[model samples]
Target: MNKTLAEVRTESGYTQEEMSKALGIGISTYNQYETGARNIPVDKVKRISNILNIEEKDFFVPLKFTLSKIKKDE
Candidate 1:
């Protein structure tokens, strides 16, 4: 199973504060990224990749959606 950005961070044993500091940003901003409230810049993503020693591709999560069809009577 794939994990979220927050999960990855926590699994790496780094707190939100530490990650924010390492990225030279505010804690709230980092939280927003993890919570999907804000979009992380490409450069920032690169920075995070370097910091976490993980590939940038790992950060991308594919979204799944289900669509329902309505039945109609002729």
Candidate 2:
């Protein structure tokens, strides 16, 4: 199954704060990317994928799908 950016980041054992620091971006920006509130630029996606040790395409999973999965789990 495909994973959301947040899921992949959590599995990789990095908190949002740490990820933002590593990416040299603000926590809010990172959160926006993870939560799909804003479109992440390709360069930033590449950096985040590298940090999480995931393929860049992983971030392309549809946000609605991810949200539905989360709701189901809850």
Estimate, for each residue in 1-74, the C-alpha lDDT of model 1 and write its tens digit: 88888888888889999999999999999999899888888888999888777899877733455889978898
| Candidate lDDT (C-alpha), each | 0.86, 0.80
Question: Candidate 2, residues 9-74: lDDT per residue as tens digits?
Answer: 898899999998998989999899888888887788788878877777656733433434344554
lDDT of 2: 0.80
Residue pairs with clashing backbones, model 2: none
Q: Could you tell me which residue pairs clash in candidate 1?
A: none
Count clashing residue pairs per candidate: 0, 0
Instruction: State how far residue 70 of model 1 sits from its true place (Å).
Output: 36
* TM-score on alpha carbons, each prediction: 0.76, 0.75
Off by over 4 Å in 2: 61-74
The candidate 1 region of ten consecutive residues with least summed lDDT is: 58-67
Considering every candidate listed, which one attains the maximal lDDT? 1
Model 1 spans with C-alpha error above 4 angstroms: 61-74
